[model samples]
Target: MNLYFPASSDKKTVFSAIEKYISDQQFIIVNKDENRPWGGFYVIDEAQAGFFIETWFKNVYDPLPRLQEMVSPKILVVAPGKRLSWQYHHRRSERWKVIGGYAGVVQSFTDDETEIKNYHEGDVIRLQKGERHRLVGLDAWGIIAEIWEHTDSNNPSNEDDIIRLQDDFGR
Candidate 1:
């Protein structure tokens, strides 16, 4: 947990460091997205992130069931002053927990109107499906624990589900 990324380090370097740390911790990093306009993310195994659900039936309980297909959890690291694209998903909603630093979130239920809010560590924000939303890093690296909740159980959301309306990097 004593990872460090110098201020001058590039995205690739930061991501590589994170990957190495994850590997050293015996956690499987399923994906690494380092080409984003803002910050990047690492999709890790659910168990590594401590994502588990307890189910109960007939006075009995199962404490180790994981909804891997219904949810995708990732850590989003946003660079200082950078923001994600104004986007929405058709098949999933999202819950973001601010885990490190501060962040600004912009959200809109309608395409023409939006609201912005700032959050700090421990704050939680929820974005429903089809809600236009974006995450902005404040003055430092913003780290967020995000969980994608797929609306349809049969089809989980993926990167292709993103519908970007505005992007600073022209993605």
Candidate 2:
């Protein structure tokens, strides 16, 4: 599955291409974030473990609060072979980077169709507009960091778009 497109600033095309690649390999993309001064790619695995690594705002001399403002901005760890439930969001995309271990990511469609793909440390991925997705860890893993819109990442008040396609928790 080797496909390429010219350098693109088009976010939709960028995402679409990445989506196609992951899909072709049967993987899921879980997050996409653009509201920041920088961008992010967040992913998760079948064991419900997440990977959203890389640090930003390092440009700032003192970046602690800057990061915490968006999120406490810390590493995410998950056990191997775990997966998260299928769900969607009304706002905020997520970005993930595999920092350690291997993963099988699962991206889902509105109608419940899904594909599985794999990623390893140093790999990056993203999710977009109401895309139902999740991840499965192929091996014990941990994500270095997760940065998202402070107001949108996990605000329960705004989580009305959570439509679980399949759930182990009966979500």
Candidate 3:
């Protein structure tokens, strides 16, 4: 079961409700197969800073009380003319939804070839494991909701997950 809190909802009220529901063990995340087209549902909790979803894998029978700390589901705001590094992940996959402004996503499987796509608000971009991708803000500031998940559950670490082929920020 999935619960969504609107952007206008009160933070204190939502947080208290989530805390109460969790303590009562009423909130649980059910996992379905990846073949289902979309990912499994999550018990999402929102705050002013951002939001995080608690999701479980279909192979795992027991649900974790919370998601991994390194797994961050947050809003990314990229300033105009700025771009993230051209990088790939070894153990993680990310789905990005453009919420505001415009974005240009350059992604590819190999370092030699890349494809760029323009995205407007409400557009979604999915990056699978080992896919090199980069996000660029265009025209104005771009805001995107990034749902980051670990592909390898057994080894969930960001120590070497990111392989940056090119970076403008110099690391």
| Leading candidate by TM-score | 1
Candidate-wise lDDT, in order: 0.71, 0.46, 0.57
1-171: candidate 2 lDDT, tens digit per residue:
322222232445544554565455444445544222212233433232211222322332233323333332333433344455666666655555564455666776575656778876666666665777766644443233333333354552133655667765455
Which candidate, 1 or 3, has the higher TM-score?
1
Candidate with top lDDT is 1
lDDT by residue for model 1 (130-170), tens: 99999987776677767777787787788899998988989
Q: Which model, 1 or 3, shows the larger lDDT?
A: 1
Per-candidate TM equals 0.76, 0.50, 0.59
- Per-residue lDDT of model 3, residues 19-123, tens digit only: 444435443323212121111112233331122332222222144323433455444555556677899998888777765566789989898537668898767
Better of 2 and 3 by TM-score: 3
lDDT of 1: 0.71
Q: Count the backbone clashes (under 3 Å) in each candidate.
A: 0, 31, 0
Candidates ranked by lDDT: 1, 3, 2
